[model samples]
Target: MRWSSWVLFAAGIATGANAASLTQVTENFGPNPRNVGFYIYVPDKLAVNPPILVNPHWCHGNAQVCYTGSQFATLASQYGFIVIYPDSPNTADKCWDVSSNATLKHDAAR
Candidate 1:
């Protein structure tokens, strides 16, 4: 795996899933910025109320390009609950910050 791939792999592990399984597809969703992705699946028969995330795909990749949001849904759903993945922006350091660093927290007050 490449250096960045490892980082993505680690994210999959951190999410507590055994492995990452993903595919590429275009999905229709609410007003979401470009790069958003999701893999809707039937909730697992076992889970009553599964956990979710604010921006699951924020740091993850596209299907398999970076992270496996589709696979994540497959697993997360099989385990019960809903999984809504968001596409995070890709920027330097693998993070999104169109504005300069000095503008991240407070450029107005300065």
Candidate 2:
């Protein structure tokens, strides 16, 4: 099947009982201290409360670079789920600070 048709089929399977529109929203988790920006996909018709999928970029990778918000967005729209792609706090390498205490605390809070 074509890619478009596949997407439609998947969407139909996702919203088998209830269907809703799709939306993409950008949000910054830590605007004051750490700038952890993320993109969230919200579906319009949710039969039950949607589940969230957190996607973290690779080392030296930015959120925009890692998650293009295309395939995942389409899946979220069809399946009634929320997708979150978080940007790294470090600007130099654009990598998450897995060893830093401060970064750990900030991430835990978020």
RMSD of 1: 11.9
lDDT of 1 by residue, 15-38 (tens): 443223332224232333334344
Q: Which stretches of candidate 2 lie over 4 Å from their true place?
A: 1-32, 104-110
Best by lDDT: 2
Per-residue alpha-carbon lDDT of candidate 2 for residues 1-110, written as tens digits (9 for 90 to 100): 55334333444443443333232233222233565664444456543656666678898876666556347667766786755566776778887877767666743553
lDDT of 2 at 96: 80
Top TM-score prediction, candidate number: 2
Checking candidate 2 for backbone clashes, the offending pairs are: 20-45, 21-44
Query: In lDDT terms, how accurate is model 1?
Result: 0.39
Alpha-carbon deviation at 40 in model 1, angstroms = 4.9
Q: Which 10-residue window of candidate 1 scores lowest in summed lDDT?
A: 18-27
110 in model 1: Cα distance from truth in Å? Answer: 20
